[model samples]
Target: MRFLSRRLVMPNDLNFAGSLFGGRILEWIDEEAYIFASCQLGAKSLVTKHIGAISFETSAFQGDVVEFGLEVKRVGNSSLTITCVVRNKQTKQNICIADDIVFVYINPETRKPEPHGKTKAELDAEVLDI
Candidate 1:
């Protein structure tokens, strides 16, 4: 997994009990995963097709820094599946995990799934280019 982004927990991000809100974390996950899929497929016209079971292992409090990490699990003809982990940046304690987040390349005009025309090998090579 490659850690991509970090966010500082703010007061507004907390739940009534004072921990980070589950919905807020999920929103961050979706945005992070979307960006990862877009880069891997080399296309911006993609839609989130599915997200597997989400496991919340721990809580995050205000003033805590959390990092989002993602790994490409599978590359298909028109879609990519990635896994995500969000953890405390300082202690490396897992806050949440999702096994699969699927994104499908689509035609913007038609809004339908379309081939991204890239392979797993190509994505790997692109990573090396960085």
Candidate 2:
């Protein structure tokens, strides 16, 4: 499933360079992915397993609205892979600052990989595309 959302980049998200901090961006990505995955699976408790390969390219300034484009790349029997790209929207430009974010999530109560509620073939189709 695809979930696209936007959030305001306020002053608190900025660092000394007048751009958003790396930690804040990471936190936002995690929160957004968790929400997206849970909403798709109709689950209440979503726990993060692994978050890997984060790269920050362009920096975002304070007051810039960030766009997060999210999708489910691959879903396994017990785990789902979600990808997200964050962009800075400014002056008639949608700049893709950082992308290719991946997250593996699990069921919080069971402490195991969460089912993606999709068939293997369906999951594979998404995997191939991503």
Q: Who wins the TM-score comparison?
A: 1
Report each candidate's C-alpha RMSD, comma-separated, in the order given: 1.0, 4.4
- Candidate 1 ranges beyond 4 A from true positions: none
Q: State the lDDT at 54 in candidate 2.
A: 72
- Model 2 regions more than 4 Å off: 1-3, 91-116, 120-130
Highest lDDT: which candidate?
1
lDDT of 1 by residue, 1-130 (tens): 7898999999999999999999999999999999988877768999999999899999999999999999888889898999999999999999999878999999999998988898888887787798
In angstroms, how far off is 55's CA in candidate 1?
0.7
In candidate 2, clashing pairs total: 0
Give TM-scores for every candidate, taking all chains together and pairing residue i with residue i: 0.95, 0.74
TM-score of 2: 0.74
- Pairing residues by index, what is the TM-score of model 1? 0.95
What local lDDT score does residue 127 receive in model 2, on the 0 to 100 scale?
48
